[model samples]
Target: MLRSRDDKKTQRQKSEVWPMAKAHVYQRDHINTDEIIPARYLNTDKEAELAKHCMEDLDAGFVKKAKAGDVIVAGDDFGCGSSREHAVWAIRGAKVQTVIARSFARIFYRNAINCGFYLIESADAVDKIKDGDEIEIDYDAGVIKDETSKTKIQFMPLPDFALEIIRDGGLLDHIMKTSA
Candidate 1:
């Protein structure tokens, strides 16, 4: 008896499961920080509070739709606003596992890594993925699989050091863990 390809994949994944994510796509570019958390909500750096308002300005329904281990899919310049760490904080607060975009703002990229948030720049993922699509990301393999569509794409994963920081829960945590 021969198993189908997807069945084979399922069997393999059962042994080495990747993080599963649900895609929450925003079809626009330049989703700035202000829209991510709104400066007015920046008073307290509490992640839980910030989570309540994440993406409120840009998409009022976002908070309602988002869940832990979900993914944000967007076009280029996905964090292209003022240099505000709050942006990444809010996203993390919302329990979003990672973001897939065509590109990212330089500062936001750094801040995200520092915050232990994952961000992948993949044009194919952005273009092919859609809202509500169930996705799985293999960090080691650098692959994004759309479970809904049953397709996948490959991209370069972050370097080992950055992955270490993310795995340790940001630079500060990484430092504390390694230096202790």
Candidate 2:
């Protein structure tokens, strides 16, 4: 028996999984992009440089505390204000695997995904998760499990096309591949 092409694709997609990570809880609402990366760092689009200043204004120790594969959990409007992609770069550069929030500003959400950053909207998870909590997110399944609280939260799943773009490491890469 031969497997269908779609079935084969599903197997490959399942292999592309995000790792479990620790959570960095920031409970403030309306955390604008300006506060996330700051305008001072916007002079350079270099992710590495921008990452050094990520969340420095809102949480002075964030840069120092953030580790590779850590997740950011925040309250509503986590990414509001200016449509700067710098904020997205900074967060991704910091090696934050996922950002879970109650809500997000439209611009920031698009910029984040375009930059290959994963952002999840889960109000329940935001309210329950605390700093240093262990979290495992299955992006394909749209599920977030908090080990610390033993709670499971679900988010709206992105369409297959959106997931493909993210899997290709952002829109640019996806476009490049498809265009070629």
Candidate 3:
């Protein structure tokens, strides 16, 4: 189980398995969602097109090489810029199941969960993860393990309500399911 300290640490416990596609290392600060998905692609309102241009600034060919179920490990203050839900959409569209970062922008973190995008915070956890490393995220156990390195890290788990939202595929889906 991965254990971490973040604002949402008082949540529930669960575990999930997420495969890695491409890992982006953030060596800088103030990297916002715009840099992750860019505002230019927002015009189309299509996640596929938006995903095609994801992380263009940081990694030019990232979207092209990404596969489904990929998880991203990033540095501090990730998704820090504008509260564009499209950023979360693009990542989800690109098949990125989860994102683990040292820290997340408040709005971005909320938006991600609302969109069923799993976002985790762990500064030290991100340091131990490398590109192409297979990671097992045990939400209930609050543990993260790097299969390749045989290393384990800890992070705080999400709340029960948040976990339910994600399990049902975002807020919209959850609402629709319950409303029926």
Candidate 4:
């Protein structure tokens, strides 16, 4: 059986906007890489393995609780510790592609972009959004809409070049696409 044309139209519309993602709130600031992925678990660079230990030190059940496409809403200095890209990989491997925080460590910010991940810095959004809230982002509009609360928050959109890289799924993919 074929689906209705309306369903196809709806699918196309969803493709234009960011998908609705659940928020996982972490109110504490200065959450370091060590906490995000413990040093003990850094022996391998495998994403799934790393994900198993992501937030193990800080929140032991985070890996078990979080689902793919969920958003992490945290306070200032999120990802403060190591400059390792493993931290970014771990987060992504856990199926969490976006982390909205008050601020992120400079290295972590760069790593996330390089890894084709999203790190949104919005103190106001963090304060307003609670755990388990469903949210959607309008990349072109620079807005985050909380589907649960019917609230909206503005955020600075990534630069064109950065967005391009992220759109291609990392710097390497971007290069490959451009060079092709």
lDDT of 3: 0.72
What is the Cα-based lDDT of residue 110 in candidate 3?
92
Q: List the residue pairs that clash in candidate 2.
A: none
> Candidate 2, after superposition: displacement of residue 177 in Å?
2.9
lDDT for each residue of candidate 1 in 59-145, tens digit (9 for 90 to 100): 999989887778889999989888988787778777777789999999999998877666899999999998898998886788889
Using Cα atoms with residue i matched to residue i, what is each candidate's TM-score against the true structure? 0.84, 0.84, 0.79, 0.84
Model 3 residue-pair collision total: 17
From the highest lDDT down, the ranking of the candidates is: 1, 4, 2, 3
Tens-digit per-residue lDDT, 54-113, candidate 3: 777777877876776667788778888888887776776676757888888888899988
Alpha carbon deviation, residue 75, candidate 2 (Å): 1.4
Clashing pairs in 1: none
Clashes of each: 0, 0, 17, 0
Better of 2 and 3 by TM-score: 2
Which sections of candidate 1 miss by over 4 Å? 1-20, 176-180
Q: Which window of ten consecutive residues has the lowest lDDT sum in model 1?
A: 2-11
Candidate 3: residue 58 Cα off by (Å): 1.9
Better of 1 and 2 by TM-score: 2
lDDT of 2 by residue, 25-129 (tens): 888899989889989878788777888998888998988987777888888888899989888778877767768889989999888667656678878788788
Question: How much lDDT does candidate 4 score?
Answer: 0.80
Tens digit per residue, CA lDDT, model 4, 81-118: 89988888788778774789999998998898877776
